[model samples]
Target: MQPILANELCKDLGSFSDNPQITGVITDSREAAPGTLFVCIKGERVDGHDFALAALQKGAAGILCQHDVEGVPQEKRILVKDPLDAMIQMGANYREHFSPLLLGVTGSVGKTTTKEFCYAVCSAFGSTLKTEGNQNNEIGVPKTLFRLDSTIRYGVVEMGMQALGEIEKLTLAVRPAGGIITWVGQSHLESLGTRENILKAKMEICDGMPDGAPLVINADNDLLSVAKVPQRLRRVTFAVHTDADVRAVGIQGDEKGTHFTICDKEFGSFPAFIPAMGEHNVADALSAYALATRLGLDPERAAQALANYSTTGHRQNVVQHCGVTVIEDCYNASPDSMKAALRTLADYPVCGRRIAVLGDMFELGEISQQAHESVGVMAAQAGVDWLLTVGEAAQDISRRASQLGVNAVHCSDKAEVLARLLSQVKAGDALLVKASHGMALETILEGFYKQFQNTTGVQDKIAGECKSWKNSRF
Candidate 1:
């Protein structure tokens, strides 16, 4: 973000402050440096207000806090009712200084990947900035918007929500020129109550969108496929199986990557290869393709850029560890994502058993048990050789898989899960480790990388060293 005087932030956010020039903005005190504006947010475990003085000690230009911070000069602090809101307002103001074509992406799944894909595709057209890591919530989106500047010709922001109105609040802050809804799935079902409500929340991405702005959606998703688009919005469709405005045909996937034909009515058809293993990822590519086409970018160029698109860390990362091929997708899990990963594991060729180390999928509300069971059914149908389940809720997956005549085992914890997996996996076995982010299933992947080292000790290409979002959000 461009350096702004404290007076400007105070005037924009309606807070009290002197004219201190701020060069950067941050929330965590540890990340604070000289000329930084530290925002104090009250999270579940800790309060940022407690560390306001630490940030000041670290050369923060100012602190945005709800309370008066002691030890810091009064002129250096912007006092407000809510630090988060104040930061959001400042971010909105920061965004007004530039005119990058904004693309806001949100969905239960693939939003982050789709955002990255859009960034890659649009980078060919112009300079692009995308949401860093998993900063897709109200706090993260505004921080992402703060990154807008003259050099950036495009901004691809990912918007995530836990309930109704969250996406609305984010979209209003972004005021995107275009939007992409990757797909509506059973994520946050515990909070939103049902898939319909999730769809309703996801649709709020268009709330702050300008009238007649292009909105791209996944046509293959049952919830998004049939949703009626408002007349004020120009709707663009993308799908793999279903007929749509932009569709993928002649699709093919192997251990190397996925190769497919991207067919658009206006752009005709072009073949694209995404260095990822899942069909769902192919769907993500289609979502990005739709938005790029709407933005007047060349379809062929966008397709080529997709070939350069690398998979985000721990999200279907195909790697060879300990002489075994591991599909380490233990980032976040929902019923939809779990099924997709399982299907990818099934389609993935393996010289040995196709093993799936599954874990609990959180936030399903009353359907948590049913969701786990459904995943087990999917695992059985996918013909997985083994299903090693972790966590209390994931035991249901083991029970259901056993009932379906698949070899299933329920482990007590991550160590047990690892032990059972290592005992069964062979040299050519393809193992998929996946679960909700809360479960910390990545530990299993870490263990595989650490304990089961190959002669080279590190295959950087497949080792997944560039893991992001290591810190989980509640």
Candidate 2:
């Protein structure tokens, strides 16, 4: 980050007496260095106010805190009502120095993939920076905005929220030139009550953009399909099953990648491919394509750039182990994403059978039971040869799937899940492991790699190939 005066950093947020030129912004006191401004944050477990003196002693140029520290002088501190809000203000202040063409992305699912797709598309036109991983909340947005500089011509920020008004604050601060709402699902139904509420919250990305700024959307989403947008903003649509301004056709996927044709009115049609599968991923790429084209980028360049898109951590990452296809999509899950993953699993080319290990989908509130059961029905509908479910909630999946004639097992824990799989899993079987981030289902794969080494003495050769799957890769 470019250095700014301590008073300048305070600009509209608070007051600062000293004029120390702050070189960088930091939250942790341990990272405090000369010319750096330490922003005190009062978290649930640790309070940054208690460490203000330590930061100052460590050569921090200034402090932005909610309360005054005993030893820190007034000249070196910027006082405010809340440090988190102040941090947002600091980010907005810092962002005032650059003029990058910023775009904001938010949704119940596919936000990260769409953001990465946008990154690939935008960077083809110029240098770009995007929110790394799932950093798309209050704290994450400011941190992402802080990365802006003169050299960056495109900036993609992913915004995530659990309730209403959260995305509003983020979009106001981001002030994106354009926005993308990938799809609205029941991800935060526990907090927001319904998909309608989720849609309301997701549309807040347009709260800060000026009139006519394009807001790209997935027209295939049932909730977003009928929902209304602000009349002043241009709604750009993309989908596979619905009539949209931008769409994907001739969609097909296999082990190597997915290939499709992008159909846009202004750009005509062009073949596009991503080194990943899933029609959902194709929808994500379409959204990125729509966003880039509406933001004055070349449509052909955006389509070509879509080929460079890759999956982020633990998001439907496919691996081949022991001559079996394994899909590790154990990041975060919702009923919608679970269904998508199951469809992808069903589509995998396998000689023997298709097996699925589905865990719990969190934050469904009163609909949790029905949601889990529906996933079980989806498993059966996907023609899964066997369904193994972990977690207490996933028992519903097993129960419902079993009622539908699918060979299903309900494991009490990961231990039981691994044992049951080890006895039956063999070459030519395709396996899918999916759950919410809290389930830590990745450990099940680790257990498989360990048990494989014990049962077979070819552990060395397997280790050379799987690398123990120690790093969540096989």
Best by TM-score: 1
lDDT of each: 0.83, 0.86
Candidate with maximal lDDT: 2
Task: Tell me how candidate 1 scores on lDDT.
Answer: 0.83
The TM-scores, one per candidate, come to 0.93, 0.92
lDDT of 2 by residue, 1-474 (tens): 777787777788666655778788888999999999898988889999999999999999888888878999988887888777777777788888888999999999998888999999998899998998898977888888888877899999999998798888888888999999998888999999978889999998889888999988888989888778899999888999988999998886644678888999877998998887788888989999999999899888889999988788878888777756788899999998998999888777666689998899899999999999999999999999999999989999999999999999898899998998888876667789999999999999888766742243232233224322121110
TM-score of 2: 0.92
Residue 348, model 1: Cα distance from true site in angstroms: 0.8
Q: Which stretches of candidate 1 lie over 4 Å from their true place?
A: 15-17, 72-74, 453-474
